[model samples]
Structures are given as C-alpha cells and as structure tokens.
Target: MTSFFLIDDDVAARCMLATIIEDSDLGRVVGEAEDGYEMEETVIRYAPDMLIIDYLMPKQDGIETIRRLSGLGYAGM
Candidate 1:
C-alpha cells in the first residue's frame, strides 16, 4: 500500500484530507506536519511513498520543502 506524508498548517484542512484518505483507502497516512519546521523530521521518520504539502507554510514553503527533501535523496514509491 502507498503511504503518504501530509504537511499543512491548517488543522481543518489536515482533518479533511485525513478523512478522505481514510475513507477512500487510497493510502495510509504515515505522518503529518503543521509546517515546514516539522516536515524534515517527520519525513525522515516516516519515509513515506508520497508527500503532499501545502503551497504556503510557516518557516518554509512547499517548493523549499521539496527541494530539501530531494537533497536528502529519499526515493519514495
């Protein structure tokens, strides 16, 4: 099964997405982060197959997050 890591600052958005993921059974939520600061650690811990991040977040943005993650060379499924 595909595993996903979600990062977003909004609690409501996170809840909604989590619900959808659970109901759809599309994938498992391996980890979640409120902002960029936590993303790095969470990503490293979870090593999810996919990362769905918000465009805007405190401390870091999606682009930067992706860039950083890419640099880490995490080849998720």
Candidate 2:
C-alpha cells in the first residue's frame, strides 16, 4: 500500500486530505505535521511513500520542506 505523510498548517485540511486519501484507496497516511520545521525529523522517521505538503506554511513552505527533506535523505514525493 502507498504510505503518505502530510504537512499542512490547516488542521481541517490535513484531516480532510487524510480521509480522502484513505477513503479513495489511493494511499494511507502514516504521519502528519503542522509545518516543515516541526516535522523534519518525524517525517524522516515515517519514511512515507509520498509527502503532501502545503505550498504555504508558518515555519516553512512546501519547496523549503522538500529541500530539507531531500537534504535529510527523504527521497519520497
């Protein structure tokens, strides 16, 4: 099964996306984070198959998050 990690500042958005992804049988949510900064280490731990990050966030945006994740060896999408 496809595993997913979510990074979004909006709590409701996170929940909705997780539910939709799970319900659609597209993937499973393995982790979640409020923002890239808060989740850097945790996301690495989860090692999700895909990362759903918000374009805009408090601490870090999607691009920055991906950059950080890549630097930390998280090669997932």
Candidate 3:
C-alpha cells in the first residue's frame, strides 16, 4: 500500500480524507498536519510516498508548502 501524508488546515478534512483514502484502498495515511509550518518534521519523519495537500491554509499556502517539501528533498507524489 502507498504511504500517504495529509496537509490541511481543518482537522475534519484531514480525518475525512484519510478515511476515504484508506477505505477506497487508494493509500494508507502515515501522518498529517494542520499547516505547512507544522508539517516539516512530520514529513521528514514519516517520509510518505504520497502527499495530498490543501490548496489554502494558514501560515503557509500549498505552493509554499510544496516548495518547503521540495527543499527538504521530498519527492512524494
């Protein structure tokens, strides 16, 4: 199963997506964060194979989050 990381501002959205992904056999939820700033360490620690991120979030938007993740050498799809 594909390991997945979720990044979203809403706790409910993250939970919902995790459930849907797992329930549909799309992937496995490895970790989650509420925003970009809170995700750096978790991303590195979990090293998920896929990332499903929100387009809009506080502290840092998806674009910035992508950049940060890229800078950290993450190649998750």
Candidate 4:
C-alpha cells in the first residue's frame, strides 16, 4: 500500500485529509505533524511514499519545508 505523511497546522484539515485518503483507498497515513520545524527526523523515520503539506503554516511554509526536505534527501512525492 502507498504510504503518506501529512503536514499542516490545522488539525481538522489533517484529520479530514486522512479520512478522505483512507476512505477512498488512496493510501495509508504513516505519520503527521503540525509544523515543518524539526520534522525531518520523523519524516525520515517514516519514509512515506508521499507527503501532503499545507501551503500556508504558522512556522514554515510548504515550499520551504519541501526544499529543506529535498536538501536532506527526502525524495517523497
């Protein structure tokens, strides 16, 4: 099964997305986080096949987070 990791400051949004993904049989959520700061370790640990990140966040935006992850060699889609 495809694995997914979710990143968003909004708890409700995360929950809704997870539900949709699971209910639709799209994938499984391996992990989740509210912000991007210091999340590389967890993301690396989970090593999910995909990452669903919010474009806007309180601490770090999605683009920056993705860039940072990419720099650290996180190749998730």
Candidate 5:
C-alpha cells in the first residue's frame, strides 16, 4: 500500500484525517505533523509517498511547505 503523511495544525481535523486514512484502502498514514516546522524531519523519517497538507498553518503555510519539501527533493504536490 502507499504511504501517506498529514500536515495540519487542527487536532480534530488531524483525528478525522487519521480515521479516513485508516479506513480507506488507498493508503496508510505513516506520519503526521502539526505544522511546517515538523514536516521536514517527520517526512524524512517516515518517507511517505503522499502528503495531504492544510492550506494554512502557523510558522509556515502549505505553499511554503511545498517549497521546502520540493527543496528537500520531494516531488509530490
């Protein structure tokens, strides 16, 4: 199965996404981060194939996060 990562700051939203990821057959959640600050490290450790990120967050938004991830050699969008 495909590996997945979630990047969002909302606790309830994260929980809901986790449930969806677990219940769906498309992929599994291998990692999660509450904000952009944790994304780089967490993603590197989990090495997920896909990332479902929120549009807004503290420290850095999804656009910046995507940029950073791209800089780190992540090709997903």
Candidate 6:
C-alpha cells in the first residue's frame, strides 16, 4: 500500500485529507506536520511514498519545503 505524509497548517484540512485518502483506498497517512519548517528529519524517517503539502503556511510554504527536501535528497512524489 502507498504511504503518505501530509503537511498543512490547518488540522481540519489534514484530517479531511487523511480521511479521503483512506476512504478512497488511495493510501495511508504515515505522518503529518503543521508547518514546513524542520520537517526533513521526520520525512526522512517516515520515507513515505507521497507528500501532500499546503501552499501557504505560517512558518514556511510548500514550495520552499519541497525545494529543501529535494536538496536533502528526498525524492518522494
């Protein structure tokens, strides 16, 4: 089964996304975060198959997060 890591400032949105993913048999939620800052470690640890990140966040945005992850050699989809 595919695994997913979710990143969003809104808890409700994360919950909803998890529900949708699971209900649709798309994947399992392996981890989640409220922001994009300092998430490389957790992401690496989890090594999920996919990442669902929100575009706007309080600390860091999704684009920057993806770039940072890419630099860190995280090649998840």
**Which of the numbered candidates is closest to the native, going by highest lDDT?**
6
Q: lDDT for model 3, on a 0 to 1 scale?
A: 0.89
Error of 6 at 34 (Å): 0.3
On residues 12-36, what C-alpha lDDT tens digit does candidate 2 reach at each position? 9999999999999998999888888
Model 5, residue 44: C-alpha shift (Å): 2.2
Give the TM-score ranking, best first.
6, 4, 2, 3, 1, 5
Which has the higher TM-score value, candidate number 5 or candidate number 6? 6
Write down the lDDT of every candidate, Cα atoms only. Answer: 0.83, 0.90, 0.89, 0.94, 0.83, 0.96
> What is the per-residue lDDT of model 3 for residues 6-77, given as tens digits with 9 covering 90 to 100?
999999999899999999999899988888875777898898999888989988999998998899898878
TM-score for model 3? 0.91
Candidate 6 off by > 4 Å? none
Score residue 3 of candidate 5 by CA lDDT.
Answer: 84
TM-score of each: 0.89, 0.94, 0.91, 0.95, 0.88, 0.96
Question: Model 1, 8: alpha-carbon shift in Å?
Answer: 0.3
- Candidate 5 lDDT, tens digit per residue, 1-77? 88888899998998898898789877888877889874586686777888989989989999898888888888654
Of candidates 6 and 5, the better by lDDT: 6
lDDT tens per residue, model 6, 37-57: 998889988999999999999
Residue 52 C-alpha lDDT in model 5: 88
Clashing pairs in 2: none
Please give me the total number of clashing residue pairs in predicted model 6. 0
**Candidate 1, RMSD to the unseen true structure:** 1.4
* Clashes by residue pair, model 4: none
> Candidate 2's error at 20, in angstroms?
0.5
Select the stronger candidate by TM-score from 1 and 3: 3
